[model samples]
Target: MSYDLLLTGAEQGDVAVRDGLIAAVGPGLPRDARQVVDVSGRLVAPGLIDLHTHVGPGYWSIDPDPIAWFSGVTTWVDAGSAGAYTWGGLRRVATESAVRVPALLNISAVGLAGRTGENRDLANCDTALAIDTIQANRDLFHGIKVRIDAEVVGVNGVEPLRRGLAAAEACKVPVMVHIGAAPPAVDEVLDLLRPGDIVTHCASGIASPLGPAVRSAAERGVLLDLGHGSGGFAFDVLEAQLDAGLRPHTVSTDLHARSVFGPVFDLPTTMAKLLAVGVPLADVLTAVTKNPADALGLPGGTLTVGAPADLAIFEVRAEQFSVTDAHRQTRTSPIRLVNEATYVGGRLLSPRLPAPPAPWVPLTRAQHAALTRRERHIRDLLATPLVDVDGLAEQFPRTKPRSS
Candidate 1:
């Protein structure tokens, strides 16, 4: 049968799409499609599912489509950027985004309107409210999120997490907890997580969750997420976790307004950082694609027939690339996954320029200059004529002055 689109010559074999789903994927699929793209020497994998990100109406939120088109991240889970009170705004953003955006509703009703302290006011961590919100918006909210940090939770300690878990239990959804610097010890937070719960920033340098509690949590089926946000990841911490047989179950860039520019540029870059740390390419890909999908119970992580045709094509360049973690420390990766094209539901995603960073977001001078240079370049390109006079074809040619 003729397909709607066919992608040939990829490492994973030819992929055929029909009705916005994968029709077939195998060696030398028949070139029977309305549109056939020869993607020789490229690696075509399932569109990446970023398990954690902020692309909602909040302090940290950024437009996901501009990054999604080139970065191959078709699914962006807005991790706790919205709570019950602010869910409507986030829902609107999710509805309008070209990429899929499932979210983890914050336990606090205030949400992330500011950088932190969503859970500081214990009054906002209403379990009943959270449960009701999840019940009402099950289509958009997949789970619950609670930040267990010193500054975020304040004197409340793990009370917010407890409430989040209570809500999650009621809804039968998992809870993804963000861990950071602790006033309440890390163990206090880790001990309470139930099976299937996620511990984002599991290898945080600040929290340094390299303890028996963390190991026990993993044994009990709590998933670890490499939420490499502005200050979540540390090379030393991750390496230690690997040594201790506590590898992250999933890797996600907690991509937000603050971390989008550096450290956690995009999902592929975050994957490359794992590669630099000695994780196999297959494992890295699984973490970004399959593991994340499973973690959140979202779709589009495989090329199987009938799955959503969300895929990413990459030119895997074999070279030493210097990759950095949230900290300034850097490591060398032997390969780089450079995305050439991205597709969502069999439709090619159009290129979109990112909007300028929010004024409040801090940027290094170099980053600031780079953004300026990029804007100027785009302006120049658009300002130039599409084609010279010689390249134009005359649709209405005058013939002998109309024989007058």
Candidate 2:
């Protein structure tokens, strides 16, 4: 009866949202609601949760909220962007950020800041230091992540993973391993991982492909994740596996600056790719929502009453679109899912690329002052209406925001 908002989705009746939670899902939700979002004919589901993202202004990362929320991703997990040495920056973001951001601490001590061989030096796999870091920051970190590519492992091979698994064991959490590059091939990598441990980038195109070992691991309960990053995903790998019924348990874009430009433009784009490649829409939705939340130990990928009102409304367009992968492979599909609106705990967030100017409805002085009081940064940004010279210089040493 009394609620803040009401929403309607395809195959589902009117749903009521009240006090930052799903109040009910049925026909004729009360007309006394404060806001009504008639998303009828579209897909209304819990906000998407990205299991792997390199999110931040820090190294190997990018500003997660703007890129993530625009594409219907509400929760993001940073995969091995920070280690013991560089964990502070990410932790700070997680604490202050409105979106849910849990991370997998890197096994390497220096993190991904340096040139790519983070685990090349065997000494960097400091389980004790990693344990200390996890022990200190229990809220920020949920598990361990290690990239076992030949370049990352160097001569050490699977030792880094062994140590990383030990650290995860020490912290009593899950482990996510990135497979590619060899010496310690796919089978060897899967051998180190436990039942619940995650194997990211599962649709990798390589000589070994998804052999008996990978299928066996999945049969035994290991979670497969389609972490579609650069050189990590391929059309062939995904199609064969799907045809053979080796479906990935979760879908996540290895979202970072590089992948954001193409192949992995955003989460919806990746989901669209799966649908194009023959995955059922419902299964694709589950891969991005519930399955990820369950795997990452996060919350709110459901529309249950009293649950967090983190929801995403998507406009499913039946038109021609192109989906590409890291290997320059493309699959043209007839459907695309575009994000229409995102709700975070029932609060509507303003997007970065806002709608075209709407006659410039001026805000009253009192309203402006109150908004300024609530959001100081927006006030400052609009007041200047240009740039923050000093702040920009501080953040970007390589390129100045201004000539001076």
Candidate 3:
């Protein structure tokens, strides 16, 4: 094909890009005119899209471009970094900075910041304000973000959720609710969520669980996204949910300054962890690319002709890696991998890195006790051998009995 530029290689390749869309693809092309890339021994795929991230660096105190472009994540959705009150500021600083950062306005006025129990105020979620903010910033704000955690919302129950949904309906958009242990069941949140709406942090601690809830959500056509942040991802919960045929609609890093140190190093690392956990490479890519794009109602990732030339190249290496979440639960799994580089519109954004170091920190007495309690509860569920699905046995294989 007569193309403007191309990347000639077997494992990875680029295409002719005009303006911002991909014009042609496949190895070999003109040596002059525009530019040429050589991707030799790496698998090339569409640019990673993180459906959930707190990109508000100023107020949310999370770095914006820390991992977005460098970690192969071309686009990200800021999950509740701002609300009606701070939406304008977030747009000016965070969203318009360097990468693509669509926002999910928090139902609470101050967003996930302010105080711990800010969402419990009830008055923070002025439906009118939420609707107005969403309408005013229609292009930037795509959905409502309501965190339905017991600790985050205290005794507010589903008031924040209700407000979020009401605002979403008014704005003609979906609501993304953060689900974990909470008052109004995850099922309740799923029941309220529509087909286009999103449920983030779907699989968290075992106390609240995620399998049954995810099954229900899938049946209801609600989208479940892996908001794998520091504290929001539980290995046991994800393994269980996936085994039960409850597949996530998206795989997001939920990347923040706090979660980016080691455990949740970057989006590529997070994706590799999921791959190690048994999610197929194609499925994982779909979750991060097409699925999230569809959920966010954006058009970017994909190698199909006429699409954007955004891409990521990765090399899966044979190495052992330890994955850790916010709760300090560590899962040491073999088959570690990392990103090689990233491209946006046929332009290389950032090169990838080598395998990351371990991220587990020494637990204190109180923290260790808490982690023990959490692990024991998860074990209780795992002990009763699942009879319904043999898939569970394969996904979360254990040679030794889980700790009691």
Candidate 4:
């Protein structure tokens, strides 16, 4: 049978797509398709799923499409960028985005309108309202998110988390809690999480969650996620976790306005950081792909027949490359997964330039210079002609009038 599109000669074998789903996958499969792309020697995997990100309308949020076109992150989970009151705005974002945008609803009604202090009031963490919102918007929301830190919760401590958990429990969904500096200690937050709950920024340098509490939580099936935001991750903390036999279940870039420009550039860069920390390439791939999908129960994490046709093609360049964490600590990765193309539902994503950083988002002088240089380079390349005269073909050739 003919298919809509066929990917041939990929390392994962030929993949057939029809009706926006994988029709078949194997070696020597029928190549009868409307379009065929030869991707030999390229690593073709399910589109990367970022378990923790901010793509909704908020102070922290950024457009996911501009980055997704090149980063191969098909599913951008907007973790707590919106709450019950602000969900309508987030819903619009999901509707307009080119990639899939499932979200974890924030517990506070204020959401992330400002940088922090969403939960400081406690009146915003209305459990009943959160539960109702989740029930009403199950299609877009998968779970709940709460920032349990000193600054965010202020004197309230884990009360906001408890409210979030109550909402999640009522809705029968998991909760993804952001861990950071303490007033309520890390133990207080980790101990309250249920089996399927997720702890984002598990390797945070500021939080230092490397105690018996973290270990016990992991042992009890609590999933740990590497949410590498601007100040979330530290190389030392990750190394210690690796030494302790506690590998991250999923790798996610807390990709938002502030972090997108620097340390957490994209998902692949975050994966490379994992590679530098002695994680196997296969495990790293799983962390970005299947593992994150399973964590949030989203689709498009495998090439299995009947799965969504979202895919990422990468050139696995084997070379020494230096990758850095949020703390400016650097390490060398043996390979770099450079994305060649990203596809969603069998359609290739077009190139999109990201908007300038928000005014409130701070940038170092070096970062500012780099952004300027990149813009200049793009402008220079686009201003030049794509091809010369020889590359063009004349459609209508002038002929002597009526050789008759």
Candidate 5:
């Protein structure tokens, strides 16, 4: 075959990636391939996209970036680590790395600091702070990230969401809200979200369960994301939602230190779990690739010749594997397969990869110079007086008086 690379396998049939693109895909290859590898038991598919992941400074236990290289995720969106107060450093870290990191600016200025004293005061959610942050580092930031779960928001309820919507509106982008176990009900949160904004952890396993209300939201064009994390996804809720025709528009692993084992081993493992739940293989691929690509406005999830050669090769096996939800309930099935390797722009990476660097190494001088410029602009906005925030308050929903 006259191909640069050739993969022959039962699942793959015959596939070739050449000149950093999928050059050929059929039953046979040309005789002049520069490299040919037999993959008889492995499956071939597009590299994964994780729309929700917790690898960030807040998840201080782990390195925020390189989770993609370790988990077979080619593209990942860091779900809110730095809001207005700290977005500069996070953006700087992302720009200095080779990993592709798109971020959802957290609604809370302090970001995800878990439980008591964690929820930054509502006043800190300055619409001006958010707008200026977005304007200053618009290239790195996308949308707003609000953790609406009860444990994360406490007595404040959906007030944080209101602020997030305001910030998203101010920045002219979508807001991705974390749902499931939120008070005032998921319905209330859904009501506040406009079409095109996102609801993640849609299959949340706890108190504020998902139901027909979610289906209604889906019908109204709200993006439902299955971001199965350590405490979000519930099998019962997910099954019920699916039964009600509220299929998740995107499948993601809200991968973190706590969830990246057995049940949520990696992004591919999460995909396999969704497949076992009656989602077709092609549909699963779409959830992780095309859907997220459209959501994030990125490219390279298809086999279109001339696109970047980012791909994942897997071995769909009959070996038994167990999948567990947030509550530790097991769902063992015998059809899941593991990723064999991943390729980014034609560079293949083994699945048994080690963990990425930690503590976020300092940026190079060139990178430091580039990041400093953006940081200064955001800091300047934060220094602006409260009088300059009237435009933001207008975006907040006006509280209506109760009828007598």
Candidate 6:
């Protein structure tokens, strides 16, 4: 078969495309038909699918393309930012977006107004309305989202989750529940979820002491997803779980306005954090790609013979990079995954995130200092680094040990 482009990576091959679907892929193929662009010496894989991101009409969400395209995520789901009362506004925004947006319908009618919790009032938990909203927009609606944080639904208890689970059952879709500090307890929330249901923020300290209930729910096929948001990821919590052999089914950045500036920068950075935490690189790749797509039953995770040519080009470099969790704990990794460009439906997109760095470019003083400061919270939360302020020029650099 003829080919359009060849992405030579660890899995080197010439990929062919016809009407958006990948027609064929192999080495030394007939370069017979169309335009051919060669990207040799890069890492190529399926476009990332983040199962949990908070993207709406920019209330809690950041403009998704700037964050997603830069991170090589072609598809993402806005966890719980719009509901029955605010769905129209978000729907309008999704229509104008550059990224492929799939949303998990929020249980609260008001969705996430400003940064306020959506499930404060018991009246906001409307199963009938949630079902109607999903039926209205079956193209965009994929599942149910309920943030069962203690602060989110103080007195409302787990009624929102109950309503969400009920709606999910009626709609025959999965429910993605956000587990935070317990008011009704984590086990009660776990009990309500069915197989294929997702429990996000599995690494947060808030969802503590997963003894039998979490394990039992996992045995029943309940999926655990990483939802790294502000105060949503803690190193100790993740280490404890990882040591106990609990891994996330999907890795997602709850990228809103709050997290885009620090800690939870983007999907690539989030995946890098998991790698730093000792998860295998292949495991990290699968969590962001196939696991999320399979969980949601999407059609474009793998580069199958007849699948849409959604792909991401990445550069994996070895450097002294550090990642900080929400609890102010830090970990460093020698291998960092950086996104270069992305393609959706066989068409390459102009990158919106900054272009990838050289294979081995050193970080500038300002850049290095910023990263060090972000992680130094583990040591002195109040104190600043004691570097020579006068010698901070890019040319006169000092190689200091990275802060943890």
Q: Estimate each model's TM-score.
A: 0.97, 0.84, 0.80, 0.98, 0.78, 0.85
Task: Encode model 5's per-residue lDDT on 328-353: one tens digit a residue.
Answer: 77675557756766777677754333
User: lDDT for model 4, on a 0 to 1 scale?
Assistant: 0.94
Per-residue lDDT tens digits of candidate 2, residues 1-404? Answer: 57898885545788788888888887766677887777878888798989989874344566766765578888889898899998988888887766778899999988888537899988889999999999998888889999897888888889999999999988899999999878778899997778889999999875235788888889889999999876689889888888778998999999875666565879999998898888888999999988988997787888888878888888889998898888878897679998888887887656663111123323447645754564676656678746556555555557647956
For residue 143, model 4's alpha carbon misses the true position, in angstroms, by 0.2
**How much lDDT does each candidate structure score?**
0.94, 0.82, 0.72, 0.94, 0.72, 0.80
lDDT of 5 at 329: 72
Residue 137, model 4: lDDT of 93
Model 4 regions more than 4 Å off: 402-404
- Model 4 scores worst on lDDT over the 10 consecutive residues at 395-404
Summing lDDT over every window of 10 consecutive residues in candidate 2, give the lowest-scoring window. Answer: 353-362
Residue 7 in candidate 3, Cα distance off native in Å:
2.0
**Candidate 2: where are CA atoms >4 Å away?**
206-208, 353-404
Q: What are the clash counts of all predictions, listed in order?
A: 0, 0, 2, 0, 4, 0
Relative to the true structure, candidate 4 has a C-alpha RMSD (angstroms) of 1.0
Model 1 spans with C-alpha error above 4 angstroms: 389-391, 400-404
Q: At residue 294, what lDDT does model 5 achieve? A: 81
How do the residues 204-312 of candidate 6 rate in per-residue lDDT, one tens digit apiece? 7777735778878888999988899877788887787778778788999987766666668788888888888889888899999999998988868887789878888
lDDT of 4 by residue, 203-304 (tens): 999998899999999999999999999999999999999899998999999999999998989999899999998899999999999998988789989999
| Candidate 5 lDDT | 0.72
User: Candidate 1 or 4, higher TM-score?
Assistant: 4
Q: Choose 2 or 5, whichever is better by TM-score.
A: 2
Better of 5 and 6 by TM-score: 6
